[model samples]
Target: MIKHIVMWNVKGDTPEDKADGALRLKTAFEGLMGKIPGLLRMEVGVDISRVDYACDVVLYSEFDSHESLAAYAQHAEHLRVREELGHLRIARHQVDYPVTSLPVCAAAEAA
Candidate 1:
């Protein structure tokens, strides 16, 4: 499986504006979950830190393979969401990695 993670910096001069923009983006990303193929799971997060360099929002998703992730990137529904979010975001960062499951150890062994 492939895990895709993305973080976005919202564009706004005021704190309220940035907060609202983040919520809007979070909602938009969450809405794309079931509509796209190969999208096994989707999650969105709003940053709560007071740090100056913190990102406004984040998206975490999983797919079956690289091909599935590529298709999702070009999917019309996703494109539409991206287009809508383009104006509200100032910067974006993304990373994709393959998920490798490790064997589960016995309870006593884990302890």
Candidate 2:
């Protein structure tokens, strides 16, 4: 499986505006669920820290493979979401990596 994570700093002049943008971003990305192939999971989160350095929103998603992730980048629905909300982002960061299995603590497994 492939893990795709993204974080964005939204563009807004005030705190309220930024919060609104973050909510819109969260809703937009969550809407992708069940709309694309090989998209096993999709999650969006809005930051609550309200700290100066925190990103406004974060996206966590899983794909079957690299090809699927690539396809998602070009999918019409994905593109449309980007076109609509792209301007609301002031900064974006992303990371993609392949994972076989998540590590579980021995104590947890014993329980």
Candidate 3:
């Protein structure tokens, strides 16, 4: 499986506007499920920290494989979402990684 994660710093004229834009993006990303093949799961989060360095929104998605994730990147629906987001986002960060079953707490559990 492949895990794709992305974070964005949204742009707006005011904090309220930025908050609204973040909600719009969160809803749009969540709506992409089922429409796109290989998209096993999708989760969107909006930051409530109100901190200067906090990103406005984050997307966590899962795909069956690297090929599946690649297909999703080029999918028409996803492209449309990207186009919509282009206007609202000031900066973006993304990472894709292969999913593994190794337990992150294995050492702690052993102790």
User: Which runs in model 3 stand beyond 4 Å of their true positions?
Assistant: 106-111
Candidate 2 displacement at residue 79 in angstroms: 0.4
Listed in order, each prediction's TM-score against the native is 0.90, 0.92, 0.90
Question: Scored by Cα lDDT, where does model 1 land?
Answer: 0.92
Could you give candidate 3's per-residue lDDT for residues 48-107 as a string of tens digits? 998998899999999998999999989999999989878999999999999687557985
- Candidate 2, residues 11-100, lDDT tens digits: the string is 989999999999999999999999999999988999999898989899999999999999999999999999999999999999999987
Backbone clash count, each prediction separately: 0, 0, 0
The deviation in Å at residue 60 for candidate 1 is: 0.6
User: Which lDDT tens digits does candidate 1 get at residues 26-73?
Assistant: 999999989999999999999999588988898999999999999999
Which regions of candidate 1 are displaced past 4 Å?
A: 103-111
Which is the better candidate, 1 or 3, if ranked by TM-score? 3
Q: What is the lDDT of residue 22 in candidate 2?
A: 96
**What is the overall TM-score of model 3 with all chains considered together?**
0.90
Model 2 accuracy (lDDT, Cα): 0.94
